[model samples]
Target: MDFRGRTVIELGAGTGIVGILAALLGGDVTITDLPMALDQIRENVRRNAAAVAAAAGRARVRALAWGRELSSFPRGYDVVLGADVVYEPRCFPALLATLRHLCGPRSVAFLSCGMRRELGAGRFFDTLLPPHFHVELLRRHDDTDVSLYRLTQQHDDTNVSL
Candidate 1:
């Protein structure tokens, strides 16, 4: 997709790989994770600063805990990225809430998940589909046991396409 001049954020950005790559592709990126993960994200951003500069893209690090106070994060992002974010059963509701808060009807979110039975991945999708969002499968990497999904907000008046 076109990243030029687009605003993007990555949720649960462990090492900030996705955000740094997005920055290198000319997106204005915010690489976010829990408060404890900020230092690592910052270091990754620092390591990729040259590429980000060369691409004329900007990247910043932020701390965002899902389902908590969300006033600090800006809304209406064109795209949101999440990699391996749906592992915890207890976090499903929080992550869903965060996704709804950040995405609009036209906004797109890419979520990558490892479908482990012990992680309660099915339960996450069951809660996500009805009242808040519509999801479409983007791709599945069998070797890595990962599935990527594209999500759009579910509007009262319209059906959202992925």
Candidate 2:
């Protein structure tokens, strides 16, 4: 996609690989993980900073607690990225809420996760979405499912193109 000048945030970045990919692809990206994952994020960021710098793309790692405060995040990002973030019954609501708060009116979120028996496909989306998103299942990677969503709050309509 055309992410050359877009500010992007990557959520649940296990090793910051997904965020790395976005940065490498020319998107301005910020990599976020829990406080415990800071080491991994730093290592990956350090290893790739030279390459990313040459590409004119920037990447940074910050501590993002999903079930907690979202006010720590800076505002105005064009895209929000997440990978393998579904499963916990208790954390699902907070996760989706964080997504909504981080992404502004005209933002697109790309979430990739392998839906398990626990994360029911029927009740896929949380009920808290702002009713202004277009969700699309991009493709299934082996047993993992990668989905993309276009979140636009300018209007109040949820249209899914199945």
Candidate 3:
């Protein structure tokens, strides 16, 4: 996607590669993960700092826990992106809550996930989302088993089926 001039946040940034990519794409990025990932996150950020800065915007590393809810996240952003974060059943509720809370006046979300049924997490999101958001199919990359979806603001209707 054209990330130019967008305030973006990435969830479950295990290696920070995606955030670095977004930074390179001209997005101001904040990469967050569970506190346990702090060391790798810092290392990755340090390794890519110059490139990220060269992309012409700020980049930050944040501590975020997926299943736990936060009253307010680091900041409101125009776009939220996550890669390979869908795993486990509890993640759906918390991730959705986080996305719901982080969503701005015109926020957009990009979620990159594998099609592995063993994970069985994407279905939860698919079954759960839609009433509160509008989903658009984005490009599915061939390099990895990852598919990117675009999410935009909409209403929440608990009764809607996935």
Candidate 4:
């Protein structure tokens, strides 16, 4: 998608590669992860600073623990990105809460999940997510068993029980 001038936030960014690429595409991107992972993300962001600047895009790193201190983050982002973040079933509620808080009526989220059957990935996509967001399958990579999904907030009061 065209990311120029868009406000993007990436959750569970490991090395921040995705967010960096978004910035390089001219999006104002925020790459976030747990406190312990910030240094690695910051380092990667630094390595791509020149290219990001040339693209007239911005990338910033922040520490974000899902479902904690969410108020510190600004609401209504244009896009949200997450990769391999849905593995832990225990984290589903917090992750869902985080996604709900970050996304506004017009916001869209793109999540790339590496499907590990033992991890309950199917349950997350089928059950946990449908209540709060309208989920669509954007692409599937069978070789890698990774599926990319596009999600938009569901505004109906009947489905807002999350």
Q: Which candidate comes out best when scored by lDDT?
A: 4
Per-residue lDDT tens digits of candidate 2, residues 1-162? Answer: 767899999988989998988888788998998899989888998999988888778898888888577887866589988887765767867776787678776787877666665665325553445453556656666544544444444444455445
Model 4, range 1-162, lDDT digits (tens) per residue? 789989999999999999999999999999999999999999999999999999999999999999999999999999999999999999999999999999999999999999888999988999999988999998999999999999999888866677
Q: Please list the residue runs of candidate 2 whose C-alpha ends up more than 4 Å from where it truly belongs after superposition.
A: 126-132, 141-154, 157-162
Evaluated with TM-score, which candidate comes out highest?
4
Relative to the unseen true structure, what is the C-alpha lDDT of residue 162 in candidate 1, on a scale of 0 to 100? 57
**Candidate 4 local Cα displacement, residue 10, angstroms:** 0.4
Whole-model lDDT, candidate 4?
0.94
Would you give me the overall lDDT of model 2? 0.75
Q: Which wins on lDDT, candidate 3 or candidate 4?
A: 4
lDDT of each: 0.86, 0.75, 0.78, 0.94
Better of 2 and 3 by lDDT: 3
lDDT score for candidate 3 against the true structure: 0.78
Error of 4 at 35 (Å): 0.8
lDDT of 1 at 101: 82
Tell me the TM-score of model 1.
0.92
Candidate 1 residue lDDT tens string, 8-109: 999999999999999999999988999999998899899889989999999999889998887778777999999999898888889888988888767899
